[model samples]
Target: MKPKELTRAIVQAFIIIVLLIGLYQVVLSIQSVLSYILIAAVVSLVGRPIAQLLKRIKFGNTLSSVTTIAILMTTFFGIVSLLLPVIFEQAKNLSLLNVNAFEATATKLMNELSIYLLDYGVDLQSWVDRSLAEVDYSFLPDTINTVLNGLSGFTIGVFSVIFISFFFLRDSGLLERMVMVFVADKNIKRVEKSIFSIKNLLSRYFIGLLVQITVLFIVYTLVLLIFGIPNAVTIALVCALLNIIPFLGPIIGTVLIVFLTMTSNLDASFASVTLPKTIYVLIGFTIGQLIDNFLTQPYVFSTSVKSHPLEIFIIILVGGLLFGPLGMIIAVPLYTALKVIFKEFYAHNKIVKALTKNI
Candidate 1:
């Protein structure tokens, strides 16, 4: 290739890379605003049907939205009020446990394991020592405190979401008309179809989530109570809420539940040691999650959004890397929107149609 052509191509690639990096930085900077928009979308999708139901019951659209918001607000506050004290107490005890005993035990175990591995010629001691040297053991307390401080902000966001959802629920007609006018003017059928697909996907996903959350809450409460765990009700409620986040949710929930159960009984505090307790927790979570993945979401959201597990995982990882926990939460819905748009493009593309015919 000519030097001028090659130089032009090189400059183009450089410009693209710089632009992408700048775009990513901007995304991260405005992530909190993006998070609120995502939360509002999900809430609006979930509450739309209820608002319609209220309208059918003779309420005006504004009144219906108000009623729906009121129900959600009441339910949320009621659950929070009941569970707050127990959760706070458990969190305090868990923190104290970490400082007083757990950290020492963990350090001792690591040292013993390192020694054992060195005897076996594994050379694991150096790795362990390096890792320990780099870690800030004191960071846990600060992390927990930071998360606790953020709860008030989270609550305020919840209110913001509800307020935004009200506009969506009450003024949906105007919004639809505006969208239709814009799309019709541009003659963009694909965009229209993609939007509808995303709306349906989000609506179905939220409904499935509600059903799964309710079932899991019941199951968790019963199982924990049967296992003689203290504060089972509060723990179960917390677990249900946490489980809304997908994969990592269960790990955090399990750790918190197990820690609470351990402290609830000095005798059965053999949580980390007892085979029965560990197995029970594993088996219960496995069954519950299996039911949710296989039955609930599939049946409810089958027509809405369909993507492979690997794709979903990638989206989640990217989202979290860009936006943290909130990104992880909205990854599925965003992916669903992408999937719908791509599918429509595939369906209409002449090349794709020819390839399908050949296959």
Candidate 2:
């Protein structure tokens, strides 16, 4: 190529690269805004059915949207209010905790475990000592401070999400219109169909998740109460919330419940009271999980989302690998959306056709 032509091409490429880099930096700077938008979109999708129901009863568009938002806010704050007192009480208990007593209790338990495991040649004491030596408690104060500092941002984000969700609910097609701006005229209709399908499927999927959490919460609370665990309701809520993360969530929730249960009555005799109670609580948790796996999950995954169980498992694993817990939480909905889009644009592809057949 001529020198001048080569020079011009290099300049053009440099400008394009510079523009892309600037866009990336801008996106990074505005990431919080993007998060608010994504969250608001989910909120709107979840509330869409309520808004539609209100509209069917002759409510004005604005009135339906306002009422839906009010209902959602009330429910959210109601749960928060119920949880806050328990949380504060727990925090106060932590602040006033007798560290030496806790340590002694832990040591006693470890000793008993070591005695039981001695026959198997497992030296838990040495392992525990090494683990304790490596532990870092210095992050506690900094973590607390960070949480306190982030409160203001969290408040702003909540308000922003509510504001955006109201508009989204009031104008059901607003997101579609925004998306249409970037689509070619020829593809606009296909994109519209895809959006509509995604909205419906995702709305049901999210609602199904809410139902699943509610069921699990009820079961967990009953079990905890039956076992007379301290802060049973709060602990149950936390565990139930964790179940939103698919396969890994239940295991984490079980471990958390067991830990909390054991710690709650540390003064009691381990062999007689603590161990038996922990075992009972663990059994209850297993029952709750059985109900969830056999009943709640099938309806949610097969009926609401219309995805195969194996497909979901693989996607969630991949998502967890790529982006951790948040990815697992969102993987199904994102996958559902992509499948819809692909089916619209690539109906002839065998894999796309197979994946999207249920939709």
Candidate 3:
């Protein structure tokens, strides 16, 4: 083949490969719509035992699941409502963060530094005022509107989740029975083991994540409150909830809290006031993470999932990239299912060993 022709062929192959990968990703995104239902089913299975226990005590599964969901909805919506007032107050206060306040704080800081240090000729106040004035605040409203719309859409999904969860809770036994029907009697043991593995692993992962978030929430809340931070509860709750997403969440939370503290305490200036806020965030996250990795996760998840740290990290990254935050949350459970499937498949194949060597 001519060099140009060969190069053209190679380029065509690369483009085809890229297009195939992109198509696969699009399919995965479409699949995520049903993945949400799958997650609700998993959650229902996990909580079905509790529902059944409640049933034995005279509560119907529908009533028990409704009660559980109601409590969950109330807690989540209550927190959101409580925090929104404070957040809106802070957001509206944004309009009040005029150039005058910026200049005043900058002037105060420069004056303080000038008294002790060599003369710094920089006009910090002018610089700050000019920067604040030039800031494009036009997009802020649109950004907030987009976020509100997304949240409204999420509420619609929550209704579907609750609807699906009700049936799974009420007829959870049917789930296993249905699966069993597809398996021959001889394969029943293997299928049962795989199912149990999924249940145990998913339950442990969810419970572990919940415990970690709760611990972090308490730690951050106490630290923020001790430092006299306004809206401490809201900030801490947000930070801790973010911790559920592993590495990326705490970083976003820290930036948010720091900006909030800086804005709320301009009189104190950033340097002097920022220390407590930064320190509290660092300490709370560090301690909470230590407890999760060393004490909680080992007790709850390590044995059940039996996944390596690197594997978990990769799975989380893939999940996040493929399906956004929801994917990240479900990554571990899905990985656990895959792990069980691989183990079962290998065991099944071993039973059908070749009668002769490859020759």
Candidate 4:
């Protein structure tokens, strides 16, 4: 290539690279704002049906929107209020925990296991002692302070989400109008159709998720109570909430349940009291998960989102690979939105047609 031509190409490439880097930095700066907007969008979508029902009953748009937001706020705070006391009490107990007593119990359990495993030449009690000796209790206070410090930011985010959600609920087509600003006039009708379809599907999908959590919460609570576990309701709520993250969530929840169950009765005999209780609790957790997997998940993925189970699984897996848990949580809704857009704008593509056929 000529020197001048090569120089010009290099300058152009440099400019493009600079522009892309600037754009990325801009996105990083405003990510919190973007998160608030996105969360508000989900809230608005979930409350869409309630607003519509109020409208059908002759309520004005503003009144319906306000009422819907009020309901959502009440429900959110109600759950928080119910759980906060239990959480704080548990935290207090943890802060006042008798570390020596806990260590003694643990050592006793380890000794039992060591005796059982003596045939294999494993020194379990020594290992447990070393692990316990290395633990630092000082971090707990700092962690609590960190959480307290974050409450201010959390409050700001909550207010921002509510402000955005109020506008979204009041103006049902606001998001559609925002999207239309970027589309060509010729494609306006198609874009509108896609937005409408996406909203309808996502509304149902989000509601289905709520139902799934509620079902799991009830089942878990029943199981914990039947097993006479301490703070059963609080534990159940935490476990149920974790299921919001797709495939990996239930496994984590199961581990958490088993750990908490065993720890709650740490002073008891490992082979008799603690171990048997943990096993029973695990059985209950398994039954709850079976109901969720077989009944709740299928309806949410298939009926609400109109996506095949295998397709949803693949998308969630890819999402997790790319962005971890947050991606997996949003994978289905984002994929559903893309499917609608593809069906509308790229109907001629055989792949798009097949993937979006149900929609």
Alpha carbon lDDT of residue 55, candidate 1? Answer: 91
Clashing residue pairs in all predictions, respectively, total: 0, 0, 0, 0
What is candidate 3's lDDT per residue for 1-359, written digit by digit as tens?
99999999999999999999998888686664576577677768667667867878998767988766666567768877877866786776666767686787677777776554545566655676799999999999999999999898787778877777777776776667878998899989888888887887777677767777788788878877877778888888888887777667867777877777666665554666665666665676677667766776555555546665666778889989977877887787877787776677564455222211110
| Backbone clash pairs in model 1 (N, Cα, C under 3 Å; residues 3+ apart or in different chains), count | 0
Clash list (residue pairs), candidate 1:
none
288, model 3: CA deviation in Å?
A: 3.6
lDDT of 1 by residue, 115-211 (tens): 8888888877687678989997888999999998799778778877887778877887554565577665554777777787777777767776777
The alpha-carbon lDDT assigned to residue 148 of candidate 3 equals: 99
lDDT of every model, 2 decimals? 0.73, 0.87, 0.73, 0.87
Q: All candidates' TM-scores?
A: 0.73, 0.81, 0.72, 0.81
TM-score of 4: 0.81
Please list the residue runs of candidate 2 whose C-alpha ends up more than 4 Å from where it truly belongs after superposition.
1-31, 56-59, 88-106, 136-153, 230-234, 263-267
Give the deviation of candidate 2 from the true structure as CA RMSD. Answer: 4.6
Instruction: Note the residue pairs that clash in candidate 4.
Output: none
lDDT of 4 by residue, 1-359 (tens): 99999999999999999999998688567867876887899999888889999999999999999999999999889867776766575566567767888788777877777999887888877887899999999999999999987898799999999999999999988987888899999999898889889888998898889899999999999999998888899889888999999978999999888877766776566678988999999899999999998888898888899988888899999988865776787788889999999999999899998998888
